[model samples]
Target: MKPVYITRTCQIANDQLVMDGVEAVLDYKEIIADPALRRRMSRIVKMGVACGLKCIEGLTPESIDAIITATGFGCLADTEKFIESIVANSERLLNPTPFIQSTFNTIGGQIALLRGIHSYNVTYAHRGLSFESALIDAAMQVNEGKKNVLLGAIDEITASSADIQRRLGMTREYELGEGANFFVLNATASGNKSAAVLDIDTRSGRLTDDKLIEWIVETANRNGIEISDLCIVANCNTATTDNIKKRLSLKNKPLQFKTCDYPTLSARALDFAINNSTANKTLIISDYQHINHSLILLGRG
Candidate 1:
């Protein structure tokens, strides 16, 4: 597959805006100008729409060939609102805004509508594999001669959702969290960083440590990178990282990317790799609930 260079990175989390690894001032009022529209958007909507808009700030809508987004729980607050409204109003004269905003493609649709972009737009919601799937699609878009593909992943945590996940044992390793991250993919190298998506693969159900290690090595070898040369960004637990280091006989200690309950945190891990990794090849190993697993290989373009 052809390399897809990440030309720009934007993230909005914890009331902060990070662009291209640099922290900048964030004002939603500036990003979403209309006061009335801003009032109606939920937290997730604001975060996603703002992060995406910030991602393509200078580029014209015509240059953006695609808008691809991923989320595990799309617009939960809006979903709850719509459901509650159905119950409250006895399913009569229901407000359409919440229902409309609760769809999986809300963010992507909102971005396209705001920018007047009439290109390919899609959203993925495959649990922990959501971001990886979106990324795979973005890479394919770039390979097919598409330029400036805006890819984003966002998932917001709600009170009810957090309680439910805790009851389901999803919060054993890390607390529930949420954020938004966006990237612009191009076929050619961008700036001095030279970060590009080398490869991405996802798996469902239980994945053993040995199998995970084997996948990592296979991905490295397939990309012409030696196990010794790959700098691993462990998005899984510490025990898993330790096992990988010991079994692979790696020279460098794997950099542990702290995990959270957010299904799309791997997107943040990808951003961390692009900004923090100095190695020629970086591999991010991510696992969620020991049921979903993924390997993302990134390297210089």
Candidate 2:
């Protein structure tokens, strides 16, 4: 298979959402303050379009082939409000707006509706692996010969979801936040860019320290590269996977690994990999543990 080129990428965080390397056009906190569902949806779609425009300047909406999104908790604040309204109103005369905006695919649908894109539309909700799944699907679509694909990952933190995460021992002890990350992919260069996508793969199961290291090494070997060639490693900051750090140290490959400080900060790693990439390659490996789930691989295309 040929390499899949990344045309552009964008991110929306609490204080900032960047397109390519530039700051986003809108602030996430300001958008969340809007009470109306339709207004919120419109704001999100607008921000997406703005970012898309910045990434692929002068590209028309008609050129996009598909829209795919990965959301860990879609419209979480609305979902919580709807549930609260049910309890507050004794399950009577409930407002439908919250429920309507709470669907997982709402963002993707809004984007398509605004852009008039009618091709492959998909939304994945696999906890932390949500973004990875969306990225995998986007790559597959491009590999299948789609010229351009719009891909994004969004997650909003609400008090209710944070409470659940606390009970499940997934969130940190302090506050919770929200954010979105979007990207565009193409089979051929959208313009004159020449980035290469080396390879990507994921695994799910009980993997030991030795097994994880071997898997990563084998994955790199498949692409005709070695751990030594790896300049950086991006991973999630989860205590359960301390062994991964130890194994990397053992390899002594003189590589740098950045552990996302914020839960959604993994997108920051994506930005780093794209901006700071050198020698035509970079590897992004996300290891998520949910009932023994994991996502591992190298990305360069």
Candidate 3:
């Protein structure tokens, strides 16, 4: 696959907005003009829509060729409401709003509806690999001659969802957190801090430490990058990263990027590497719930 350039980035998390590695005012009214419509949107929807709009603010609708989004738990609040309504009303006379907005494509659909972008639009709802799947599609779109591909990932924490996940033992290492991340990808671009997605690989089930080491070396070797020279951004845990470094005999320690766990946290890791990594090439190693794993190689293009 061809390398897709990350031209712009925007994120909203912990009640803060960052664009292109710079802190900015997060005024939703400024991004979403219609007051009534804004009032109707859920937290996740507003966050995703606002972050995505801010990402493609300067670009025209004609310039945007596609809108792709990913989410692990799609619209938790609205889905909960819809389900609760169903249960309370005895399966009758339910409010249509929550059910209407509970789909996984809401973010991408809203962005396209607001921007009048009549191009390819899609969404991915894979467990922990949601963002990576969306990213792979976006890169393929760019390689297929698309421009200004708007790709985003969003997940919001709700009280009910958090309790259920805890019962399911998902919070053993990290608590449930929520954030929205948007990136603009294209085939060609020139600017400062220029970066591109060089390669990506994903796997399921259990991955051993030694197997992970072999995967890392193979990814680097195939890309013509030395394992020692690549700066590793750990999106899993400090202990795992430290072990990988020790076994590989890497001189530079891996940078810790994961504090809390989320399905789309790898998107944040990519954003961090794009802005903070000083190395010419960076590798993001992500381990999600010891079940889903992925490696994304980023390079300065």
Candidate 4:
């Protein structure tokens, strides 16, 4: 299949989650130009829409063929608030605003409405692989002859969600954070300025070191490159990194972005790789629960 190009990108990460070498969190504007609608939507919705608008800057909204979003915990802040109201008011006469905006697909729906775009819109909620799933769908759409696709990942941490994450052992070494990262993808480069996504692969369940190494080798060979020619970027701790490197006998250390929460981990790693001009060929690896992994290969064509 022909590679899809990333024409534009807009990333909004939690301030503390951003890597030291990368740009800081995006300064998102609270108001969305429409006063009436601005008063109804939640922060997450506005944030996602802002990133979406930025991604499609200088382009017509009608040019977009689809809008896909992935969120681990969607509208968590509003969810918590709505739950609190339900508990306080005996689940009667509660404000519908919170409940309406708390859906996992709200971001995609809101973007579609705001832009008057009536195209294919979808959302994915596949835990750690949510963003990867959305990316996969967008790529598939492009492969199927769709011209332009808009996709993103939005996840936020609330007091309720934070406590749950702690109990689930998801915040052991990484700090809880939030983000809304958006991108515009096309079948070909818009004006010879886009980055090509060579391939993407995601795995679930148990995986051995040999199998992991083999997958990397096969993917690199398919792209006409060697392991040494690609820079590995992963969201992993020192121990995990050491295990992978020692097992694969890798000399080039992978760029680690393990300090943030799940939703922004892989997105931030990709942001770093794209922004770093010195990196020629980049490979992104997201290791979830030390078992399931998602790998992506990107380069300039």
> Against the true structure, what is each candidate's TM-score?
0.98, 0.80, 0.98, 0.89
Q: How would you encode candidate 1's per-residue C-alpha lDDT over 171-288 as one tens digit per residue? A: 9989988999999999998877759888898899998889999999888888888899888999898899989988997766799996676889999999888889888889999987
The worst-scoring run of ten residues by lDDT in candidate 2 lies at: 252-261
Clashes found in each candidate (C-alpha, N, C closer than 3 A): 0, 5, 0, 0
- Candidate 3, residue 215: how far the Cα is off, in Å: 0.5
What lDDT would candidate 1 get against the real structure? 0.92
By summed lDDT, the worst window of 10 consecutive residues in model 1 runs over 250-259
lDDT tens readout by residue for model 2, 1-301: 6677776777756546576756646643343344453364533343443444344345566788778877665676778778999999999999887787778787777666655677888988876567667777888888888867887766666566667877877654334555566777887655333355556566665566577668777776787876665654445333424555556533332234333223333444565566555534466655444222333333454
Model 4 alpha-carbon drift over 4 Å, by segment: 15-31, 191-193, 208-210, 247-252
Candidate 1: misplaced stretches above 4 Å?
none
Candidate 3 vs 4: which has more lDDT: 3
What is every candidate's alpha-carbon RMSD to the true fold? 0.9, 4.2, 0.9, 3.0
Candidate 3 lands at a TM-score of 0.98
Clashing pairs in 3: none
Q: Where is model 3 more than 4 Å wrong at Cα?
A: none
